[model samples]
Target: MLNIPLMSNNISEEDKEVLADFIRTSDRFTNGPKVREFEEAWSQWLGVKHSLFVNSGASANYMTMAVLRELYGPGEVIVPPIAWSSDISSVFAAGFTPVFVDVDMSTLAMNEDEILSHITDRTRAVLLTHVLGLNGLSQRLLDELDRRGIPLIEDVCESHGTTMNGKKCGTFGLASNFSFYYAHHMSTIEGGVICTNNDRVYQMCRMFRSHGMVRELTDEDMKREYAEKYPDLRPEFLFAVPGYNMRGTELNAVLGLNQLKRLDGNNARRVENFKLYVKNLDPEKYFTDFRMDGQVNYAFIVLLRQASREKFERLTELLRSENVEFRRGTAGGGNLARQPFVRKRLPDFDPSTLKNTDFIHFYGLYTGNYPSLEKEKILELCKLLNRV
Candidate 1:
C-alpha cells in the first residue's frame, strides 16, 4: 500500500515496443545474435575489450569467480563486509575463503588502508563493490593491488554509468559485473553482464556461460587443445571447464540494447534528483555529505547521524505512515556479515570488526531515485524524511 516505491520499473513503453518487434521479427530467441550484439554494444559502452551477457548479476559474479578460480586456484579473497550476499557467496562457491574488511563511513565502500593490511600471501583477489553507484576505488588502492600482483574484481552491479577519473567504474578492474534487472539504471527484464579487457578471462566467461562448451570460445588454439584432449567427446559438446548455463535470451538483449541507449541520460536525471534530495535534507538528523567524485546516483541513501534502535524503529514507522517505500539497509542485503548466511557459517565472527558496516546496518535506508521522479517529488521525499 505504499505510494512511493523503492524502485519503479525502468523499462519504458518504447523499450517494450522494441521487444514486441523483436519477438515478431526474430526467428531465434535464446542466446543468439542479439545477445552477441548486446554484449558487443555493452563492451563498447563500458570501454572494455569484451563482455558476456548472463542470466543475472549474481550469476555474473559467480561466473567471474569460477573463471578466476580456474586461472588461480582457491585462496583468500578480500571483500567488503557491506556488500551483496552474492559478492561473498561467489567466493565460497568458487572454493575461496572470504576475508571481510570494514567500509569507509563517507563512501560506504571498503576502507582502502584496511584492505591493504588484510592482504596476505594467500590472497587471490580483491573483490570490491562500488556501493550504490559510488566509485569506491582510488589510485592508491589500484596501485597497491597492482604492486602486489593481485587481481581487482569490481562488483559494479549497482554502479552502471559510474566513473573514476574519467574512466568507467567497470573498466578499471580486471573484471567487472553489471546488472540490468528491472530496477537498475537500465532493464533487460532479468540480465547481467561481465566486462573485461583480458582476452583469456573473456573467453573463459563465454565458455562458462554456455555449459563450458568449447564451441563458444573464440580462441582457436584453446578450442583445438580441448578438442585434442577429448577426441571421443563431441566437438560441439566439449566441456572445457565446470560451468553453468547462465545465458541470457535474445528478448532480454533487445530490451538491454534499447535500455542502454537511455542509461546515461537517466543517470544524469537521478544525479540531479539526489542533489535536490541532499540539499533539502535536515543535516542535524542525517549524514548528508556523501563523497560525490566519480559518483553516479542510484538511490537516495539516508544514514542517521547517530545510530539508535529506537530512532530506527521510529523512522520506519514514520516512513510507513507517510506511504514511503524504502529499503532498510543499503545495497545487496546490507552489512552482509550480519546476515544469517554468514553468521551461521562463521559462528565466532565478530561484528565489531566492521563498525562502519554495523552503523549502516542499523541506521541506513534508501528510497527510489529514477529519471521519472520529478524534482517536486524529491523535495517532498526530503521533507517527509526530515520530519522523521
Candidate 2:
C-alpha cells in the first residue's frame, strides 16, 4: 500500500561481501575480536575514550543507567517528554524517579530553562535525547549542569552525526548511547554501543556488557583487585554486578565496521535532503523554522502551524492517496506523559502541561528521509502537502 516507505535499507552489497568473507575465514562468531575492533573504531569516531558494544540501543540505555545507579546511588533523573521509551524505562529500571520536562518547539528537545528549573537535590542526571537526529543540546545547558555537578547522560540513539559546538552530541555527555538498527544512520542488523570518557564507567560498562565478569574489564589492575577481593569464586566467573547477557556478535560488528566508513557521506546527503524539504514546504500552513544548524535530520517533519482538525484529516488523506508512508506523533510517539506506561505509574500526570509536546502529538508527522531519496520526489511531496 505504500509507494514511499518510512525506511529503506542502507546496507550495501559491499557490506554483505565483507560479512561473507569474515564468516568464511573467521573461527569466532560471538562477542570477540571483531566486536572489540568495532567498539574501538566507534569510540574513535565518536571522540570518546571507550565504547561498549551491546545488543540494542535499549540495552545501552539500561546499561548506562545501571552503571550510573551503581556509582551514584538511587535518585531522580530529569527527562524529556518527547523521547524514546527506553530512555525513561532505563531510569525506572535503575530505581530512579523520572521527572518530566517540556520540550522546546524549535529544536524538539527539552527546554533548557525547564530542565534547569526541575533540578532538585535528588536529581541524579539529565537524560536528553537528540530526537530524530536533531542536536538537542546547548552551551548554557551544558554549563549549568557542570556547575551543579549533575551528570548529563545523552540518548543519541537516533542522532549519529549530529553535533553541537563542533563536537558530536554523544562526546559531550558523561555517557551516551547509539543504535545501529537497520533504519538508523547505520546498520548492524541489530546492535548498539555505549560511549564514555570516564575510565571507571567504561570498565563497569565492559563488565556489564558481558556477564559482569572480571575478565571483561580491560584494565589488568582492576581485574587483579576484583580477583583479590573474591578468592572463593573463580576470577573469570566472578560476577561483580547482576548484569544481563546483552552482548553483540561479530557478524553485527562486521556490518557495523563496513557501514561506519560511509556514515559521514550518507549523513551529508540526509542533511541536504532535509534542507530541500523545508525549503519548498508552505511555511504559513506548516512549521518549518526548526533549528537546522548542526542537524542531520532522519525524517521530514510536517507539523501544522495551527490546530485544525480539517487540515489534519485532509493531510492524512492526501498522504494515503499518494501512498507516502508516515508516522504521526513523530519522535517518541509525541508526549510520553500521555502514554499509558507513564499514566499507570503516575495517575496524576498531566499532558497539557507540555504544550509544545502535546501540539506535536496531535498535529505532527514525519516522513522518511534517507541518503538515496530523490530531490524531485522531495519537491513533489512538499507540493502535495502544501496543497493540503
Candidate 3:
C-alpha cells in the first residue's frame, strides 16, 4: 500500500509565484531577452561557450543533428541501442544513417569498443546519451574520437550536473543537449537547451532555433556577411538554412533561470540517493555494479543479474502489488534497435550483437529517484525488491 509514483511534483510554490509575477508585469512573452539570459546562464553553469533554448528536449535533439548535418553534411551517426527515440530519430531527420552499437552494461552507454569498431569514412558523429543521469562518456572515447576528428554529440536530457574528469558531460562534446522537463534535474515547465564550445556550431543552432533567421545570429560580423551574400533578401528576414521553429518562450526561460539556481544542490542529493539504493539492493538478484564515479541519476535503475522470465515478472508483480510505479527497459523502453522505426531503416539489423541492450530491454526497470524521495521509502522498496 505504498502507492509510490515515479516522480513527485517538483515545481515549488516560489516557482509559481515568480511565474505569476512575470505574467503580471511582463508584456513580452515570446522568445526574447529572458531566453537569451537563460541560455547564457546555462552555458556558464555547464562550462560551455554558448547555449540555445528550445521548445523541448526532442527539438534540442533535432536541432543538434540538423546543425551537425549543416556543418558536416550527411553521413552515418554512430548511436547506442539504449537511448531515447529522439536520439535516433534526429539522425534520420537530419539525413544521416544511424549505425547502431551495443551499450555497456555498467554505464548503459555505447560500448567504447563497439563505437570504435563502427567508425568508417561515412561516420559523421557519435550521438551519445547520458541515460538517466549516468555519465556515458569516457576519456578513451573522447581521445579516440578526437584523434579521428569525429564529433561527439551528447544527449544529456536526463542528466544534469553529471561529470567526467572534473568536466561536465555537456562540455565534452562538440554540442550537447539538456532538458528542463518536469521531474528532471530541473524544470522549465517544458524546455531544453543545446550547449557547445564551437562558435560555428553555436551560430548554426541559434539560427536553427528560430526558423533559420539570419537575425538570430549573435555575431554582428556573421549577420553582415549573410546580409551581403543575399542582397536581394531582407537581412532581418533571411533564411540561412532549412530550419524549424523550435524556440523556447520567455515564460519557459523564466522558469529555467529560477530552477537552475538550485540544480547542483538537488543533483548532489540524487547522487547520494542512487548510491544508497545500490548499496542496499540485493546484488545476487540485481545488477548493482553500475559505474558511479560522477553520476546523478534521476531514477533508480534496477536490472536483474540473470535473464529469468519468472524473476522479471515477479518483480513487476511485487512492485504493482505494493503500488510502486516503475517502467521496464530503463531509458526509452529498452533496446531501441528492436523498435519498428529502426527496423524500417535497417531491415537486416541483428539483435544478437546487442546482448547487453537486449538483456536490459527484458530485465531492467527504473523507479522514481527524485531529490525529495525518503531514504526510508527507498530502503523499504529495496526490501520488497529483494524478496523477488
The global C-alpha lDDT for each of the candidates, from Candidate 1 onward, is: 0.88, 0.91, 0.91
Best by TM-score: 3
Model 3 vs. true fold: TM? 0.98
Writing each residue's lDDT as its tens digit, candidate 2 over 173-258 gives 89999999889999998999999999999999988888877788889999999999999999979999978799999999999999
lDDT of 1 by residue, 150-262 (tens): 99999999889888898999998899999888888888989999999999999999999988889998999989998898899999888888989999999999889998898
| TM-score winner between candidates 2 and 3 | 3
TM-score per prediction, in order, is 0.97, 0.98, 0.98
Give the C-alpha miss distance for residue 133 in model 3, angstroms. Answer: 1.2
In model 3, what is the error at residue 340, expressed in angstroms? 1.3
- lDDT, residue 197, model 2: 93
Candidate 3's C-alpha runs over 4 A off are: none
Worst 10 residues of 1 by lDDT: 1-10
Cα lDDT tens digits for candidate 3, 1-388: 7677899898999899999999999999999999989988998899988888998999999999999899888899999888889999999999999999999889999999999999999999999999898899999989999999999999999989988977889999999999888868999988899998899998998899888999988899999999999999999799999999998899999999899888888998999999999999999999998999889888999999999999999999999999999999999999998899888988988866798999999999999998888989989988998999
Candidates arranged by TM-score, highest first: 3, 2, 1
